[model samples]
Target: MKLKRYLWIAVCLIALAVSMLPAYSEDFFQHHREFRRFLQHHTGFQVSTLGALNVGVYEAAATLAELKSHGDFGLGTFEGLDGEMVVLDGKFYQIKSDGVAYPVKDNSKTPFSAVTFFRQERSLRLTGRMNYQELRSQIDEQLPTSNLPYAIRLKGTFPSLKVRSVPKQTPPYSPLGEVISQQQVVFELQNVQGTLVGFRLPQYLKDVNAAGYHFHFITSDRHKGGHLLDGAFLNPVVDIETLRDWQIMLPSNTAFEEASLE
Candidate 1:
């Protein structure tokens, strides 16, 4: 009995040591450290509500240490439910129904205050520390950049824009990059009967980032009404997460299916 008890104690010690090993703790510490560093350097974070039913909100926690870092940061309460609440710098930004982050753009753009924003609401503040995995997963889901095909669509007068698949380009960094090919799409502004006003399609687009894609559309004649029609197919960004919810234009990757004044 003495030997068995000693063996059990030894096993517990080993398990405890393994649990404290570097690998298990590394990711946690890494994220925590980065978050701390970000908060230290960038004190100008705003808290905002992100969703409607499943509210997930974000606090800018830090400036762009890396642009990709913009994709990080989220607060969630339930699984698969959008975390609509976000607290940053002690300010509260309520999530509206449109799934856009509004910084309490009232009176003066005085960066929302926790007291003012939540004054009228009956919801209580979240307890405990932020959860990174839950937050990260929620954030990733909201980024239109990650979910490309549906995230990016060509609608408008040019919904039927011709896409001719071409040979892929070889990036200096990629070994099998040659496997991926590109499509050359052309958009032209025409009348109701299909009268050509102008056409534009760029040779390349920089980083698209829906999952891993970039897009660029060239306009042939901007000086004329071409901008109204030809510009219909163009967008500033494809990923929705990178932009403020009420952004005038979607992120750089949004393409149009057809053009209309609406």
Candidate 2:
């Protein structure tokens, strides 16, 4: 009889618990919905004007000309304009040409400040008008104190510098090889500016006749492995060596011969 009583009590407890499940679930979903609504409504403007942009920073000179011709002069002036921040209703818009303010149609395109606008443009895309003040507040709360740009200096300079228009240079060795294991790795040359160059890495060394900057590549692989690759044809080479014992290697050509891993 006692066993049966215990079993009956257990069943009753489970039944009671089951009966409360629906109410709990309903409350949970309701709470979730409310939270979503709050985020959507309260921060809608903030979210929409996340990455508005006016022009690319690299094209600042040209953009400044355009702005001077078409954009609002009261917004700012151009020159020494390295970056830009397009804001509307106080939100982040875009990084672009310095000193040039584009006409923002809505609040959905602005980034926080010039620096953020430039960085954000690399990650995001804006389509509409942005609020300047609202975006600014969001930036104030979210960004680091030191990172926030003020009116004192060139605050919005990224958009103007974001322009990337270098002619493509297809490498002869389209696919560079990875450094071999056990090989000491060091940068022999890096053609970042692409001044004297060629398709072949060797040819570039020959043309420039100089060993460029070198960075040591210390890999964990016992067989010393590293990648000699670039996002663009930015040919950069590495020399291989053991961790304790390092060796210096330079280009075979006389011009590059002088290059040293200093």
Candidate 3:
């Protein structure tokens, strides 16, 4: 009887102690639970496929406002492959072939793009300078697995950055390959402080999106950037968000229906 009483008394003390915790304890726990849910439910959304773009399907499938309902950070091309797209902090930007960045209107349309809510899982600070390939390789090594897609954002002052953009095509569209080679404009920027937004996708998604690392850059002032081709990071921090699930919205157009994706 004495032992049982003591055990009951101990239980009561524990319950009291828990109840005496600061009122914020409950709120903290609630926020923690919500954050966990965000991490688990983080999703990547894409509009149209690269294969469709390659086949000359330039019609808009989704508007900027519609995309906001899906994700805030991502990259893609405007309708007609007009320019490079760099999405940051829920703001959409169109970097034209002229190497100029413009704010995208909510009604603007995209033919091929991918986006995510950007719930960061980790951040990395490099100890030495790394170029495009080296930076990707390093990040690759740190990923939990090679099978999942990851959204990465890196901000820093770069030594050199090479980017390009394609001119907006007119009616009677041409294939993407031809447009890129003949109409693309490249820019070389040095000592520029900016944020690089991109993703690392698995090869299995080749038909749906970029198979490897794809990135776009925008200056800190949110102007003058394009599709990132190469760059050197000087020990900057990289933010990473893991996306275990994805949804792709195929265009409901004749071109997409008839494209020779095979």
The best candidate by lDDT is 3
TM-score per prediction, in order, is 0.17, 0.24, 0.84
For model 1, how many clashes?
A: 29
What 10-residue stretch in candidate 3 is worst by lDDT?
35-44
After TM-score superposition, the amount by which residue 163's alpha carbon in candidate 3 deviates from its true location, in angstroms, is: 0.5
Show the lowest summed lDDT stretch of 10 residues, model 1: 111-120
Residue 24 lDDT (model 3): 64
Q: Which candidate, 1 or 2, would have the higher lDDT against the true structure?
A: 1
Q: Per-residue alpha-carbon lDDT of model 2 for 1-262, expressed as tens digits?
A: 9999999999999999999999999999999999854433221011100111111111112232222222111121122221223322232122232212233322222111111011111111222333323322332343233221121111111111111111111222111111112221223222122111111111223222112211111111111111122222211221111111111111123222232222
- Residue 3 lDDT in candidate 1: 100
Output the better candidate (2/3) by TM-score.
Answer: 3
Local distance difference test, candidate 1: 0.25
Error of 3 at 183 (Å): 1.3
> Candidate 1 residues 1-262, lDDT tens each?
9999999999999999998898878989999999865543322122221111111111122222221122222121111121122332232232222323333322211111111111111112222322323323443445444312211211123222221111222222121122212222223433211111111111221111112322222112211111121222222112121211210111121111121213
TM-score of model 1 relative to the true fold? 0.17
Report lDDT per candidate: 0.25, 0.23, 0.89
Candidate 2, poorest ten consecutive residues by summed lDDT = 44-53
lDDT for predicted candidate 2 compared with the true structure: 0.23
- C-alpha lDDT of candidate 3 relative to the true structure: 0.89
